[model samples]
Target: MGRTTIGKSNAKIILIGEHSVVFGQPAIALPLPSVTTTVVMSQTTHGQTLSSRYFDGPIVQMGQNLAGVAALIQALLTRFDAQDTFFHIAITSDLPAERGMGSSAAVAVAITRAMYAYFQRPLTRDLLLATVDIAEKITHGNPSGLDAATASSDVPIWFVPHQETLQIPFTLQGYLVIADSGIKGQTGRAVAAVARRKTAFAQETNAQISRLGQLSTAARQALATPDLPQLGHILNDAQQQLAGLGVSSTELNHLTQVALTAGAFGAKLTGGGMGGCLIALCPDRVTTEHVKNSLLAAGATDTWTEAFNLEEEHQ
Candidate 1:
């Protein structure tokens, strides 16, 4: 028997900016420390095995849908010079998949970290980013690299494709209420849809994308100044732009409206947006509770709240 190794990664959510980010626009993402994915690895006489809610069997026997994870395991094995090693990799996650929560990236990060630890090798941030990116490609077809980067980071990130990622400092003076629509989001399909529309309505689409970029810039400033109202306004504008792009769905709109009616400072569909979850910004804990209850009444499948305190965060 060999030594056991464990690794963990936090989930992530895009605070603002999604499809537009692909076109070199900036976006913001926050790490969800409360939600996480963990991977445990140990030597086994048998060939590679995986145990998770979705699958339980030899890694080779996993369905094609798991090809992304399979490719990641193989890559790690080769990188560590342990191609012949047989290990049982067990995965557990609290984050829901297909909800724009960076589940796949979190899994890849956790597994990759576990493998490095198993080999007693030093794992650098650069290596971790590069390695997890390979798996992200398998899952997202063409990821913006935002998910992987944010999943591995602890603080909020400001990302511009092909440029350096910046960490944004701020104190969250309010609460974010995340409400699930209970529908799976098709990120690849959504990206392709946006591209097709861009071709059909080049000028209109490009203008909207540019507006989203502008909103992201304003959002960055609001975050720095810790202006909750200004941030909320920017979010509302971003959602309107996203809706114009045709990514917003009826369910998402309904939930967003409900949250707003319930006194949320701002509300918008997060992630790929065809279907997934929407986030509502509440000015305080009382408003957060009101919105959460209202979302439940409005048919939200699930809801969770994250509170932010800049003073505590700095400490």
Candidate 2:
């Protein structure tokens, strides 16, 4: 009986520690402004219809892998079918699908939030995150549950795969420059590959992840204290761990080197990493711009800059 609309949540880039996180290492992720998804609801005469517009592909096709999302809507409709709560859902996002940037999670968060608003109910972050996790199963199969957590709450979070999940509201200093390689990474395949490899190299991988996790704790403390140099050092170590996991691509490696050579504070391949994007931690705008220029010079297809803050936004 009431219309509802939910504001979008931004996607994220792992500043450091990728595969290491899978083994229980700590990773630093910062939300990006360029990628976001919003859900809008309005009164209609028919049943619920989901419409999404993405950066690429057809708009209607955006719902291709959103089975859990569809299921959630169906369940709601069944519960209120008598009222026939006619709803029209429209999704618009800057996040690209399958890029390991938490696009699907953003959509799921927005959808759940909108649904809550429709019923004049309070929306809790936990409820929004849980709904997104269900949808993640369709897209990521066995996702690490990090992306949804990040999208649901915009901040630097510490997730220990299967061990622990916590959020640290540490305000980050300086800017983050990200460059897309125009190569899409299959997160499902990458996660599956890592799981398969775990059986053979469990001891070694677990040890590395544990080390990364310990280092991550120190890094978290450093982040809280706002020490940029120490944070950069941890990022360098985390990148090495990710490389050892065999996720870093040659192109991504080249990009990382280029950023480092250009005087970037820290640089590493982010996301699923067989291909995707690289995030460079820069100490200042000057360095960030320098790294960005170097990335473009080295054939990076797209580049974006964002300033991350741990403080919540004013509604």
Candidate 3:
């Protein structure tokens, strides 16, 4: 590489569809501008190495959890026809690992961008996502590609398996309050569990999955109409389905309940669940604060807010 290169990617949240998306259901993935992951690349005399909180050594020696990153680096080098390339990759991220905030996917996205930039190769959005998915497959056994897509996009997205993603116009008249439950989320385990649940209770499981898909469809229409309350209701309904599917954890459920009790229009766990973050829909900035405080009081490690708008809507 000629000089140091930097690549950045923001976090993302699955607005509704989760496990169901893997089964060909539509999903909404929203970008979380509050946090981000940045990867820095520079020349190194030694062989390829990675520096991050989780590991610091040769890329090949990284733990199983980081296999995706290692694989991405290998794949990138091979693509560049520089197998003997030596460089250092350093990752710094505000996106907490295992919080359903797309940490792994963001990292992979950042890495791919940096690699492409350092190689002086043009990168397209399609190429970027495809490259990142290479790593995602290693990290998440059967990822639906929502994380990579949303993490790289600036706007919200409507996602479906084996289909091109479409950006959804953003317009809502409320706020979103997100809180971390302070425990590592086992996305792999949660996804596998859902698969087992589907096998053990095919009919019921399929029904819930279909319900989540329906809710997603409704959510899209609600967003188009800019119906905040209706959107919140959809989120609440989706949460119930997720709970029935056995993915929600006690901490997540309690936090979501605390938000609802605090007057959130609706609330639910936002990702693979089992232990992660919960998102609450608040009617205004005032309610957003209340929900944020309530989640913290209910044991949330941190909180964030996203506002659709406060300006009066003709509706």
| Backbone clashes under 3 angstroms, per model | 1, 0, 0
Candidate lDDT values, in order: 0.88, 0.72, 0.88
Ranking by lDDT: 1, 3, 2
Instruction: Give all TM-scores, in the order shown.
Output: 0.93, 0.85, 0.89
- 127-202 per-residue lDDT for model 3 (tens digits): 9988999999988787778889899987789998898588888777677787899987777789899999999999
Alpha carbon deviation, residue 27, candidate 3 (Å)? 1.3
The global Cα lDDT (0 to 1) of model 1 is 0.88
Error of 3 at 188 (Å): 4.3
RMSD of 3: 3.6
Q: Which residue pairs overlap in candidate 3's backbone?
A: none
lDDT of 2 by residue, 1-315 (tens): 655666577788776666667655667666666567788877777665667653233223445666666666665455445246666788888787667787877877777777777766676777677666767777667877788777866677777768766777786677777788778875556667677767789987676667767767877787788887787777777778767766777888889889989888778777878888888878776788889999999989888787655243311
- TM-score-superior candidate, 2 or 3: 3
